[model samples]
Target: MDFEKLIVWQRSKCLAVDVYRKFARCGDLGFKDQITRSALSVPSNIAEGMERYSDKEKVRFLWIAKASCGELRTQIIIAREIAYIAEPLAEKWITDTRELSKMLCGLINKISD
Candidate 1:
């Protein structure tokens, strides 16, 4: 299966891009880097998993992607609290990460079974 064809992967990729663009001018380099890396990991892990030959490997990567979703969500919440992100945008991203995590879980279960 092509990871690009997966809705979760596609949405995650878009989210990462949005995060990068949104934080491009951020003054706090450490926070920006951490958040962006987590955001990027979602789709990256998904793609890596889908490209793997074994189900075990695929499930492992999906789990990593799900973990990244959680990490990204936490960062988004912190960003909003710190005023680095706007309320509306932070909420949207948080919602997106939740959905992506759920999607990754579903994929992992399906692949495992």
Candidate 2:
């Protein structure tokens, strides 16, 4: 599969945009930067990995992106606890991450298989 064409990449891009949009306008500079960085890492790693010449590299980058997703999950939990993010929005983001992570893993499996 073309990693660039993967739905997870598209969703991760959206997720990054959402993270930036939500936090960029906020007054908390620290949280905003951290969360946005983690979110941006997801798709950025995917794109970087796709530019590689090997499937192993692509999978490695996808795993890196997946790890970024985990970081994003943590940031979401913190943002929720501190009331930086609304519960509904946090829930939806977490749900999206969970689903996308699963699908990305599947895509990796398909590529390796």
Candidate 3:
């Protein structure tokens, strides 16, 4: 299966790009770096997982991607609380992360079975 064809991968890639753009000028280097890395992990792991030769390896990477989604969501909440992100945009990102998590879960289950 092509990871690029997966909706979860596509959405995660977009989310990572959005995160990078959103924090392009952020003064908080630590927070920006952490969040962006977490965001990038989702899609990267998914691609790596799908390209693996075995189901076990694929599932492992998908799990990592799912974990990254959770990490990214936590960072989004923190960013909002710190006022580094505006309410509306933060809410949208939070929602996007949640949806991405769900999509990842679905893909994981499908692949696991």
> Which window of ten consecutive residues has the lowest lDDT sum in model 2?
1-10
lDDT of 3 by residue, 1-113 (tens): 99999999999999999999999999989999999999999999999999999988999999999999999999999999999999999999899989988998888888889
lDDT of 2 by residue, 1-113 (tens): 56568788899999999998888788988888899999999999988887888889888988998889999999999999999999999999999888778977986787678
What is residue 24's positional error in candidate 2, in angstroms? 1.4
Per-model C-alpha RMSD = 0.5, 1.2, 0.7
Decoy 1 TM-score against native? 0.99
In candidate 1, position 111 carries an lDDT of 93
Model 2 spans with C-alpha error above 4 angstroms: none
TM-score of each: 0.99, 0.93, 0.97
Flag the better candidate by lDDT, 1 or 3.
1
Model 1, residue pairs in steric clash = none
Give the count of colliding residue pairs in each prediction. Answer: 0, 0, 0
Task: Tell me the whole-model lDDT of each prediction, alpha carbons only.
Answer: 0.95, 0.88, 0.94
Distance from true position, residue 63, model 1, in Å? 0.2
Off by over 4 Å in 1: none
